[model samples]
Target chain A: MYAELTRRSAWHDVLPTVLGYIGIGVAFGIVSRAAGLSILVTLATSTFVYAGSAQFVLVTMLVEHSPLLSIVLSVFLVNARMMLMSTTLSTYFKQEPLWKNILLGTFLTDESFALGMNKLNYTDRKLNFTWFNTVNLASYLTWIVGTALGAMLGSLITDPTKFGFGFAVTAMFIGLLYLQIISDKTISLKLQLTIILFVLILTYFGMAFIPGNLLILVVTLLGCALGVILKHAHN
Target chain B: MPTIKFIFWTIFCTGLATWLTRITPFVLLKKFTLPPAVIEFLNFVPITIMAALWFQQIFIQQSGQLPAIDYLNLCASLPTVISAVISKNLLVIVVVGIISAAFFNIVL
Candidate 1:
């Protein structure tokens, strides 16, 4: 159904990101392994879970034995934003078969989506399933290699604190948030700050009294509410 | 701690749910468009949840006492947040955070 992709052309667009992908992929693998996941499991997670921040969230939730539904739901909700990417790409992929479009969607990620959109808008190169899928495949291979290397190294480094990994998940979240802020540009910094401040205070004060699980829901709702309220007020 | 079976299932299910989020929208985009308010809310989720997760990490919960601050994490977070503002890159933020954490732990 798809044309044969030129690796040279695809790699041209994907070259800059290969190092970044391998670096972060290594971190994810090491953190998951040091958290007590087996090498096989870590590899499975990198292969299937796919999303970076989502995998970090999974490591924490799974280790805590959080309710199964909650884990799936949280990941679903966090990643649901990717739907916007799929929607955008669907426009570009409409010429292809439904199965091929879905297959492309399965491999879509924040980086690849941005890359695809960037190519479509600015460049003369034809953006097609073949090119996009090749980009994804190259990145995926490097990511898997990085993960395997880290998993092997992780066996020697159990307690990550001494190596400064005690707050890796939290740091990852901050990075994720900041990255979103720059990319979307629709939401004002003022609104983001207001919601963040509210969540920070709410979580801190509620921690002494509220259960962690319940607190997560309450904060998420109120934070989202604050965002919507502030946004509408401006409009 | 969960059983190996439970972990596998969680991974498998999460993978499916995540993939579905990305895949179904391609098929559904023509038939449905999320309302502006819902889109706004969905956009805020990553922000709100990230803030919550960051808080959970930096604060240590005590049974009777109010939450205690994780000094090491707190120290590292300052630079990480700054890097977030200045760099706005995930890898940069993470690397800065890791370095700050390691530096402080060694000195203090």
Candidate 2:
């Protein structure tokens, strides 16, 4: 796989993803710093976790002093869709080493998965894993570098609240939520999504009196369970 | 302040869970087909989790209480929501959000 992964090949196919990841990664770094994470923690989270939206959520939880279990669970649930994405993309994998496939799975972001799937659409039986690996490599490197750049800039602004960077994560989440809703076009689907959202929001607001340790975990699990049941009934 | 150990554990756990999500399908389900119900259930998780997170951030205060109105955030969210609906670009939406929130903080 490594033999054919030329720099030219990776960049040619993944330019858009490279640019997109850099932009999002920079934003995550700035917000993570603004939320009071040390530069080291910011780098560690981005380098280790590599899930953009979940990183923002984790930063928010850290800022607010949410319990550790809650933070982990929330991030997990947010990134869980990777399971489906990875599964779909794995179907087209050629007979590469199992380790390579597993390693590649670790790098699977939404943008990478989309690009890989689009490329896979052209092949009949023998899929090209190296090209897709190049795409992942490009996206991954840009993301890490962009975050480092943003963290440096974020460090300069001592009072992040003054620039409203405190609200950056919320803004990002809203945008993502809007995209999720608009992507699904059926009236019934929209209705179900709305119901699920409403129930989750209510649980969050209603659970304020509970102990901190149980609040986030219970609400998150409850919300997910409700969503699953709702989908079962609707379909 | 959070201890180093707590933060480390949080990061490690999040990374582990995320890795599991990314790896399980490739390893365990390569030759298997997931039930329709299970797939449907997974489909709904993203939206629900995000909505919970969004509302929690916007509506819940630091003291674990809901305010009468988070006026600044609510006002800023108007632009964010509008740009997201119209442009559907992540960069644009984030820029609008940051600018709107900053503007409201300055003006009001």
Candidate 3:
């Protein structure tokens, strides 16, 4: 394990995520601090919870003084995507010890998972436990560090939106999705685009009545079922 | 004012919930083999999830109200999406997004 950690640094593998996470973590810290959270509370949430999007939700809920139960439910709903990602990435670790897999669970953000999935799809190399741990730990620490910085300087950055920091993760996701689609040979680009368009329409039309997270969960589930049916029909 | 006790409780609840979601599949699916169709579906699920994420960011939806297009977001995102298509690099796309957003803010 120590050898793999020193082999190549593998820093390049997680460099992009590091950049995005810093911006996001700072934005999160700014928001949390702006919401009147002390620096200690902001750091505590960022360090312990570490769900990027859910952290945003927590800040908003804190501002509103929302009930604890609803806040927990909101966190669960937003982070449920991790369940899907964790399950999908599980087979990649069949050879590793259970403790390693459990340890890896700490670093499973969307960007890291996308990077991992892309690595799996586009490369011939096997998933190295050390490499993933490095990626996970580096990204995780970057987020915490950025949050600390932001919380420390939160009063200075009174307006994060003016710098368009809000769109950072969206852009990252778009880039990841674009890479995933272009690199994937198993799925047709046409089919994938179709699903995207379908989901966008559903989201735009239904978001008025449904919560965004809940709507996404439902749409993804139904769309996947439909995708499977279509795949069979085409075959 | 929110009390210190309430805030800590909220944090603990959220931390526990998020950890549960992350740990559930890892612990439960060790012996299970997912069906091939389910696997096929999972392949396409990411696209839907990504689409929802992008659309959620791009649109402005008030609670219990019709969604409206945020033209500024659309304008800012256009270049980033284009860069994503042409470059397919995360760093480049993010730079393009931030620059374009700033540019749009200035020009429009």
Candidate 4:
């Protein structure tokens, strides 16, 4: 019965997610510790914030003793896309209970959300709130464990940078980007180039005028607007 | 900032970020239906935003220097991209990319 139940569940999708989360979470923990955050704080951030990129940026800023407002602003900007993520998820999860939605919403990191969405597409299943909760719980547990390990071993370890562990997050992002490009029929090379150029230029200028996090916000929103206009014109 | 102060600020910012972005669309769309054009636009937002971020990470730098043919990144990225194109396996491509990047970084 247990095996049957496990087989019926979407644990297959959950395995890759666990691996990805644990690897990335360990990297975040190491970076956070190296940035001078205590293990407690590292664990807390992973437990509460649960946003890897934002957490990394926050730690870097804290180490620099950046202004509080600036730190907050940067994190806010990096995670602004979470809004879009939650919104896309809501369409799938509308029929689920409000409390469940809110709870699951907090755990909706990029990787889990993307995995859940793709799974939904493949199964052609309506958003099953139970399945989402199971996937997220598994991911969250793995992340916390990985974070703890990284934090504990952070000081003892040497040359993580030499190993390009820092780039693991970037590699994950690249992998996710490749998946999106391949899966979506509507995405075009020209459109991709335009957004990339716009962000690079905007980021260059934004760093001068706006704070770091806010710069991400401005660039992202501007990219969204430009994409919309370009797509509209094309069609 | 003190550690405690920074922690508080981080939490506050997390709350603000969560509420502002996550709640806005639901509140706006719950009562009102967005136009088709807007929905279509929203569909592309994820891919475009992600692409912008990925490109920026790979190509851009903060030292006021242009990304002038990062041979190491290229060497690593070439095999990575090839694996991605041919095999289409996420794990394989990532392993190849990281190994190549690290090997090149150490050697050259």
In candidate 1, stretches whose alpha carbon ends up further than 4 angstroms from where it belongs are A1-38, A51-143, A165-185, A206-218, B1-14, B43-46, B61-66, B84-92
Model 2, B2-58: lDDT tens per residue?
A: 878888998998989888889878776655766766655544444554565566555
All models, RMSD in angstroms? 6.5, 6.9, 2.8, 4.4
* Most accurate candidate by lDDT: 3
Please state the CAPRI-style docking class of candidate 3: medium
DockQ of each: 0.46, 0.42, 0.68, 0.39
Worst 10 residues of 4 chain B by lDDT: B60-69
Colliding pairs, model 3: none
Query: Could you arrange the candidates by DockQ from highest to lowest?
Result: 3, 1, 2, 4
Chain B vs. true chain B: TM-score per candidate? 0.61, 0.62, 0.88, 0.69
Model 3 residue runs over 4 Å out of place are A1-9
* TM-score of chain A taken by itself, candidate 2: 0.64
lDDT tens readout by residue for model 2, A99-154: 77887898887666644433332333234567767777778888899889889888
Off by over 4 Å in 2: A1-45, A49-101, A108-139, A164-169, A186-190, A206-224, A227-235, B1-22, B61-70
For this target, which candidate reaches the highest DockQ against the unseen true structure?
3
3 against 4, candidate with superior TM-score:
3
DockQ of 1: 0.46
Q: What order do you get sorting by lDDT, best first?
A: 3, 1, 2, 4
Residues A1-235 of candidate 4 have per-residue lDDT tens digits of 0112133464665664465566677888888888778898889888877777788888887878788787777777778877777776676666555666676776677766666544543454355766777777788899899899889889977445466554544455566566655655555767866766777676555555554445455666777788888877888
Candidate 1 per-residue C-alpha lDDT over A1-235 given as tens digits, one digit per residue, 9 for 90 to 100? 1123466667876664565466567777888887788999999998988876678888888888799999988787667657655765676676678787888888887667655644543344247877888888887887888788878888775554676755554566676666555554557878888888999998888888875545665677788888988888989
CA lDDT scores, all candidates in order: 0.74, 0.68, 0.78, 0.66
| lDDT digits (tens) for residues B66-87 of candidate 4 | 4434455546666766776777
